[model samples]
Structure formats: C-alpha cells, structure tokens
Target chain A: MISNEFYSQENHGPYELYSLGDFELEDGGEIPDCKLAYNTFGELNKAKDNAIIIPTWFSGTSKDYEAYIGEDRALNPNKYFIIIINQIGNGLSSSPHNSPDLMSMSDFPNVRIGDDVRAQHQLITDKYGIKEIALVVGGSMGAQQTFEWAVRYPDMVKRAAPIAGTAKNTQHDFLFTETLIEAITSDPGWKSGNYQSNTEIAEGLKRHANIWAVMGLSTEFYKQEKWELFGVDTLDEFITGFLQPFFQMMDPNALLTMAWKWQRGDVSRNTNGNLEEALGRIKAKMFIMPIDEDMFFPPRDCEAEQKMIPGSELKVVHSIAGHFGLFGGEGSYYHDQIDKHLNELLAIPVPDKVI
Target chain B: MISNEFYSQENHGPYELYSLGDFELEDGGEIPDCKLAYNTFGELNKAKDNAIIIPTWFSGTSKDYEAYIGEDRALNPNKYFIIIINQIGNGLSSSPHNSPDLMSMSDFPNVRIGDDVRAQHQLITDKYGIKEIALVVGGSMGAQQTFEWAVRYPDMVKRAAPIAGTAKNTQHDFLFTETLIEAITSDPGWKSGNYQSNTEIAEGLKRHANIWAVMGLSTEFYKQEKWELFGVDTLDEFITGFLQPFFQMMDPNALLTMAWKWQRGDVSRNTNGNLEEALGRIKAKMFIMPIDEDMFFPPRDCEAEQKMIPGSELKVVHSIAGHFGLFGGEGSYYHDQIDKHLNELLAIPVPDKVI
Candidate 1:
C-alpha cells in the first residue's frame, strides 16, 4: 500500500487491530494482510445480549466515536459492551495508504459497503463469539454499513440506527461523490494514485476542502455566519485556517478509496436491484435518522428508504450543521437530539428472531 | 490576447462588438482598450421608449438569449427592441483570453458587476442614445447586473426583472463559487491562468464540470431521471458527454474571471453594505424571480433579499432544473413562467422621471 506517515498508528491513538489475514473483498479482490482497527468499551456479560457496534464514518477512525460514549450517554459504557469498528479504506483500517503487501495504493481492491459490513460481521461473530448484537448504529458511511448489517444478518442485529445515510446511494449523491474524487485524482501531484507526500497534493487537497466548504455544511450554516460558532472570525479564515488544513493533513488516496465505496453503496444489489425486497429482509428495529438540512442525505431520501423497511421509523433531526451535524460540529443541541433518538431506539424491546 | 479558436466569430454566429476605448474598473484596475460584445433584435421605436436591455449570465454569450426572443415571446421582437450585452470576462467580450495589448490573458483587470453595468449604460447612452428604457431583465449573473442597473440608473430603467439571482452573494454561494475557481486554478496545467489551449487543462475543466454536476441542478432532477429529457441514456453519459464537455469548451481564465465577480456581486456595496438602503434606491417596478428548487439562489435566500427591496415582488418559479433553469436546460415550463412574469412587469407603465 502507499505508505503515508499521516495514517500511521503513531498519529491515531489507542485502537486495537483485528487481522483478517488477506480478507477477500466481495468484488473478488483482497486487501493483502487485511486488518480492521477497532476499540472496545465495558465488557460482555453472561449471554452477550448487551453488545453494541459503532461503525466509523468516512475519514473517521475507531477513536472518533468517543463523543457518543460515556456512562451518561445513550451508548453507556457501564450498561453495554461497545465496539467501534473503522471501515476499510479509512486509513486506520487496511487502506490504500497503509497496506503492507502486493495490493498497494491504487492497486488496492475496490471495497464496498457490503465488504465493510461483512468484515465487521466477521470480527463480531468470530472474535467475540457474539451471536446477537443489542444495537448497530452509525452516521453517514457508517450508517450505510449499519444498514448492511441489519439486512445481511437480520437475525443478529436487534436494533439498527442508520443516521444521516441511505441504503441505496442516490444518483445525485453518486455525482457529488464523483466531484470529491475528481478533486484529488485530477491533482497533478496525485501522480496517478501515487504521491510522495501529502504536501505534494496541497492544491488538490484545498480544492477538495472547497467542495466540502460548499456542500458539507448546510446553507443555513453559512447564511447565519455559523462558522462563528467554531470561532472563525472571517470566511477566508474559515477556509484557509480551518477546513483546508484539516483536509490537507489527510492522505489523498485514503479519501479517494472511501469516496469510491461511498458512491457505490447499494444494499439493494443483494435482491437484484429490488430495494423493497432487500429492505424487507431487515428484522432489526430500524430508526432511519436524517438531519433536516443534510444536503448529502436529505430527509426525503432517507424517508424513502425507511418506507421500504418493515416497521422502520423515519426520525428527522434538526440541525443547521447539515451532514456535519453527525459530528456535532457547530451545534451541541444535535448531540442531545442524537442521544435521545438512540435511547428511544434502545428502549424499544426488539422481538427475538424466530428460528 | 490568448486568442483561443473556440470563442471566435467562426464559432458563435452574428454578434457585434462595441468599443469602450479604455475602461476603468471599480476595483481600480484598467483594461488598455475594452470592447463589449452584444446582439440586438427589432427596431428601436422613434421615442426609444420600447427598448429593453438583456445582460448575459455567467459563461453565456449574447447569442445565448435567442431562445427568449421569438415572435410570440414576452420579449417579442416585433414589439420591443432587445439588446443582449455579454458581460466583460464572458469570453466574447473583453476578457482574460480575448483581450489585446498589455491587459492580455491573466493580466486582465478584475472587473466588477458595477463596471459591467457602467459599460452597458455607456453603450446604450452614447451609441444608441437610449433614455427612459422600458425594461431591463436578466437571470443569474445577468440578474445581478439587472439589480445594479435599477439601482445605478433608476430613472433610466422603468421596469426591472431579475431571475434566479441575489442582490448580494450569500456566504455559502461565495464558498460555492470559490470551489468552481479552485477546480480550474488548482490544475497544474492552468499555469496561473496562462494555459495555451483549453485541452492542456482537461483535468481541471473536468473537475469544474463535476462541481457543476453536483450543484448546478436540483437533486429532484437527478431523482426523476430528468436527463432523459435531454436524450441521455445513462448517468455516466449525462456527466461525461453532456456536462463535462460543455464546460471543457470554455476558457478556464474566462470562467475564473466571471466567477470572481459573481461571488462579489452586491448592489449593497453602493450603500456601504446596507442592502436595504441600496435596493431602496430603485424606482423601477421590480420583480425578483427565484427558481423554487435552485440550490444556489433558493427561494428563501431570494425572498430575504427581495424583502429589502422596496415594493419588489418575489415570484418563485417552479423548476427541477435548479440554477440551470436560467438556461431552460431541462424544462420549458420555467420559460413560460419567466415570460409570464416579464410580460406582467412590462405591462406596468413607468412613472415619468421628474428631471
């Protein structure tokens, strides 16, 4: 894989590695010496009914989900055993930037949402020997994997919260993601998926940052000068000082890998493009949560998919932060709102899978 | 002058050029010798009271307004004298790629919206000797100029209609335009705006095209497979064949110049950034038209600005085409609605300027 100093364990703190030993991807390629980086909280009790899985989002690591965990939080450390799994291609996981063998850089196999979910499935069942999960939850790409978990292993996941994401990625979203990919790949410093250092692709990274600057946050966020909430005094500073450099630190190959998979997220492929049939297979108590202003995953798109799932409820959370509200970036209110939704879903007793 | 073959008279048919001698920009830069490209239809009545000025939008030319000039159209050639003036930096006019002498290529001055209106006013007043104009109308960047015309020369413009644009660019829109600029400049081939041919910067143009693919149209347009209306069979074709190539034909420097001005459009600048005070100066009967689904100028954003303009009407047009509806790309219903609004505005007689 393309070795970039940025994606090393030295940069990201306190995450354990679970080796899949050359994991075969659903697309017929394998990540050489594949490893899924993860973290655990609390402990599994007698029957392991208290297990919860928190899948990481795009560009996120296992450690990024710490905001959602605490004794007082919905994902209570004392009450449930929580596992934070970083999806493949998110740098910390066996990604284009961190692979150690023949499959490296752009040669890294194209991974799908299904592949990511299957890997998590393998880790949860084989490593922990847990037959059932109390909850499977995540936001954005994590949400896509959560949908995959519920649909692929219906009997295993009792409750699913796919927040701010969709099972079948919309055509518009595919194009949006295409722009993100174009931003990096088109950079001359990219050198056809091989670059010396992150600094070389500086201009391209800034372009990617501008794309996010436009679509990542809701229009209301800009209209209200909400960057002020983040202590950014001027719009120029918001771009140069914050967004650009934050993204500049990321490996271009890592971003591209995740973006490619994100654009192709489609659980409906399991049922020959019949989303109705695919979502119908979900036995999990599903709460499809969408942020109202999320331009990436608008509430209507999430609601459409939610309608396909039997007994699923569409929960629209309010936030001017848009897709970024998932990270509780500009608003603290969204954090409480998300916790409330999670607690409500947890409180509903899921009917045990009938054999 | 860079002298690209694509923007030559050999390509776009039948438009005249007017010399401005030397033009001074609002930003304190100067073009050695400037020219404005324009087209006119019908005969100016003896009193010159039937004249109408149509300013071109971003990346658009004078010939592009022909769709609105049919015999039975609201801008019926038989009834009103129509002049379509291509804005400076829009390739056909004096721009980065087409200028001659010291102000050639990237050395071209940073022309503002006011500079464009001032040039148009000079052309109309000096050559055409047009006074007490019946109407001034445009869409998008054209709409920006329309607002400027109404504010800068209120007594001259009797009726004003600005469609799918704002009096001042919003912070999000500012950032959105920034991405469009980044797409081209970030390309190594761009060479700081001195690329020899459009083909040299193919990757950057493609990136710019992808950016448009995301924000230029409504998500509903994609959701409904509306590209079918344009005879496209697949999503990939719609992007690669339609969107990408359309932008590829343009000069990147020309696009950048227009986009820079577009992001800074503010009639309120005349009043030291007090939008209400600036818009209040308009004596022309005004109608602000916003496409309901326009992501760039959402009706809410347009309505907010419309509220500041005294007696101005906010007419929300229905278009799944989003901001591209200004060009009538996917729907003709918007054209009919736009014409209906124009005709309604044109029907209202102007109050005599008390000179």
Candidate 2:
C-alpha cells in the first residue's frame, strides 16, 4: 500500500492532521493513532458557532472539494468557517495505504460511516472546542456521514444537507458495490490486496475505473457526447486517457476498505433497521438533495428517505452528469444549482431549541 | 476452444447444421467450414411466404426462444414456419469454442451482425428455397441482425421488428460493452482468452454477471424487489444462484466473440456512417419496439432511430424488467406485448413493390 507515487501526502491538499490516539471504532475495531487529514477555509471565531463541516466522498481527497467552497460561492468562506474532512481509508487519512500499525495489505480494520462521523465529532469538540455546527453537508458517502452526524448528535448540528446519497444503502447499490469490489479482487495481481506496487494491480484498478465509467456517470452524459466537454474527442480516449488513468493511480486496498463499508451503510441500524425511527432522531433542518440523472442514488430513493424525516425537504439537483455532477464536472451547472439550494437552506435561522 | 463440457451441440437446442462451406464475411474475414445452427417449426407453405426468421440474442441458443412461439402466441408455429437461427459465435453455431478449424480461443475471426444475417439468408434460400420472408424480429444483438436483414435485403423482407436495440450503436453502449469485455479479459485466469476451462474464469464470469445485474435489468426491477418473482428471497441468493450461475456456464471466448461484434453493431457502416441514409433504405413495415425502462437501449435511443424510417412506429413495451424483459423472466407481460406488436406488423399486407 505504501512506497508508491500513486498517493503522496504533500499533494493531498492544504491540510493538517488531527490525531486520535488509539481511536476506537463503532464497529468493534480500533485504528491505532488514527489521523484525520482536513483542510479548512476562513477562521473559527471565539464563539465557534459559524462553523461548517464538509466530509469527503468515495475516492475523494479534501483537495477535490475546494471548488464547492469559495469566496463568491453560496458556501462562502468569508461568511463561514469551512472544513473539508477526508474520511478514513481515503489515502490522506489513516487508511490501509498509510497505516504503519496495520501494515499488512488487508489488515486495516473496517471503519463504518458512523465511525467517520464520530471521529469528525471528536475532531470538532477536542480541537476547536466547538459546541455547534452551522451546517454539516456532504455528497455520496459523505452524505451518509452527514446523515449520521445529524442523527448521532442531534443538538450539535443546526442544519444538515446530504447530497446524492441514501441513509440506508439499497439492495441494488450493495450489489453494485459488490461488482466494484470484485473488479479489484478478481485480478490475480491484486494478490489479496498485497500487490507489491499499486501498479502491480494496474489491470484491476483499470477494471475498477471501467465500472465507474459505466455507473459513476450518467448514460446521457455519454449519449450527448458530454465527454467532448472534457476535451476528449472519442469515447475510447475519454475512457483510456481520463477514467482508467484516474483509478489506476489509487490504492486498491484503500478503495476496498471504503467499498466494503459503503455496501453496508445503514443509519437504520441505529434503531434496529427502522429507518423512520432512526431519521426521527434528527433535530437538524434537513435538505435531502439527489442528482436528477444520478443512476446510483436517484431522486426517488432520496425522496423515500426524505419522507422519513419530519421537516426534511427534497431538493432534486438537475444535472446531466449524474453522480459525477457531485463536483460540478460540467461547466458549473451542478455547482451553481448546488449553491442556489444551499443558499436557500442556509438562510433559515436556527430554532431556539432542539426538537 | 473445443472439447469442453461448457458447450455441446445437443445441449444447445434441437438444431440442425446448415453448412456455409468456407463462408466469406463482410469485413474480409472467412470462417472455414462455417455452420449455422437452426431449429424450425411448422412447414414452409408452397408460396414460401409464410416463413418467419427469429435470430437469437447474445449468448442465447434456439431453445431459449421456444417460449416466445406457441399455438397461443402471435408467432404461432402452426401458421408461421418459425425459424430460430443461432447466430455465429453463440456456441451452438460456428463459435470460437466449436470451430475445429479455428481451434485457438482467440483465433476465431470477428463475426458481425451483417455476417449473421448473410449466413441466415444463405440458409433460408439454399435449404428452404424461400425467396420471400414473412417477418424478421429479434431483441438486443438479434435486433441488430434484424435491422441488417431488412436493410441489406430490402425486397426480400416483408416486415421488421427490432426490440431494445439501435440501428447504429450509441457511444454510451459502445463503452458499456467495453466494461463487459474488460470484466472477462482482465481476469488472470482468462490468459488472453485461452483459459483451460470456462470454470477457470468463474470469478470473471461472475463479475460479468454482476455488470449485467446493474445494467441488463431496469433500476425499477431491483427497486421493487422483483427477484421475488423469480422465487428468490434475497438479492444475494438471486445473484449467487440465478444471475451468476446463468453466465458461469457460458464460454468466455464465445461471449467475447458476440460482444465484440455487439460493440461495433451499426447498419449505418454500409452507408459510410450515415444512419439516416442507411435506415432510409428499409422497406419492411418497421415497428421499432424498445423496452420502456431499459437502461442500456433506452426508448429515447430507439425512438431516435425509428423517426428515420419512413413509416416506422416506436412501440415502447412498458416493463420494469428493462432489457431482461426480452425473455419473459417475470410473468407473461413481456411476451404478451411482443405478440400484440408482431401480430399487427405481420398482418400488414406486403406491398407489391419494394419501397
């Protein structure tokens, strides 16, 4: 997992590590000296009330999220203290790729979405002595963390926005994740995640990217020749040069660690598989946003979860880019839509008391 | 490629071989001692105008399609001399696995839809002595051949019906097929398509099925838990017992041969990539039926091609099963709709002159 140019700490982002010595996982595992890599914008005031926490998604680093937070954006850093926290197993954090204690390829213990949110909770309370979060927002797996944050600590989060993800992973998504996992595992070069170099499993990693090419982006994105926007003329070049090369540069172990937890993501586990009861615990003002063209977490799936939350509003983000629209892959169409909904949500004042 | 239990002539269908005897292909390749596998129903009338051709889909044999033709169905074996021809590389025909001349796994030359239709034409004319056809209808890869049949021989065909496929393969589908190919080829056991046995590539075959689990069936199919209709209690069981097992039995070389041609399927190649011009040559009463919820070959893609044909109608089959609805995997809903369209298309009188 280590000794590779595939991932280096310096290139990850403008970040600082928040260490939780002997970090205990919610899933009965521990990450010895767990490190969370986070990059922040603006400044935390003495009151620590104007703070926003944004978690990273699958295969995402804190750096990838810089576009979402800017001075001119609705998530303006000038107004709020923005923190982009990378989740465990995302290379920059205490992942299978970097953990010295769990040096073996497959030895990294499973970290649930709940574990990620709990660690973020620890980072906030311990590092900054922050009592309130103005908002906790994220997309995809980050949305799972967002949902967990709102539910696990109902009073700490004043508002929560989860984008293009579900509280409980669907049966379809679980199998979809299975294929992604299989893509890496089936390659003999993977060698049970003990490949000498990430490049040793290059074929498997490319296979992983191939799956993403089909499911990670919307079909319409290809049908309309949207890859032309990426400056790739042919579909072959788009896949060969863009998609495959992207995953070929990542650690397979890090990917599997995230994919395993992603398949089992269930906030409903809080109330013994009762999603309604689990969502009923949320005190934050909720806006459930799903990308309209997203094949994975379609609007209907998000709407089903929205109905479970008492005052939650379902905001369908229109984009032809599907799940890839999470980071505004196209010309600011997704980010612009995201800014509008977030602005509307942020405008509402926090209630005097928690529900 | 040969001498494997994975594929046998007797197990494929009640088929007889029609030898093409060193068949020449459209793409300047030749299959030495080419054989076309076919199963016929009813008798060809004296006029030989009552004969109908139903080509097999990807990985399908003649037996798998028997359910579509019966006394009660629109494709009644009693009235129409129904011929279910197995396409080249489907194992039952002159496939990579069965070709003694092309003994190596990757040695089999690429077989196009045009070649399949060409061989079927030779069989129909040479054996049955049928000059005119009643109707040509198929789905998926078979649909590609149907379009080829109508265009390549405008006067010979009376009616055309293509289901859940395009006249020219879309850019989205081309890449989608790439993932399917990569799933098999990326496996180490595949050994560049020269595996010891199909069982050796079980992991790859299962991976191939996993891809289909996501794209081959409609999202609504999984969302609504339609696997229960297949008498499966859980998704894991359905995939493990049903989907995975179905593909595990097929030869990787055979599947790849069909898939390679499938990726390049475009009747417009005849007219220098002008789809409108290529489709404009069709004179058969065309009814382009696309499965309404199909993720791969969506109704929009099919409708786009249908508009090009002068008198063609787009009949969208309403099914949650998506492309899997091609074979009545659920109830008889898919077949019932197919019969309704085929009956109307078949009943239309063949014009005295070719358009």
Candidate 2: tens digits of C-alpha lDDT, residues A41-157: 999987788899999899988887888988888888998999999998888888887878454468888889998988888998899888899999999999999998988888989
Residue B177's lDDT within candidate 1 is: 91
Error of 1 at A271 (Å): 1.4
Candidate 1: give the TM-score of chain A. Answer: 0.96
Clashing pairs in 2: none
Top-DockQ structure, candidate number? 1
Error of 2 at B229 (Å): 3.5
Candidate 2: list runs displaced more than 4 Å: A353-355, B6-10, B101-104, B353-355
Off by over 4 Å in 1: A1-11, A353-355, B8-11
* Docking class of predicted structure 1: medium
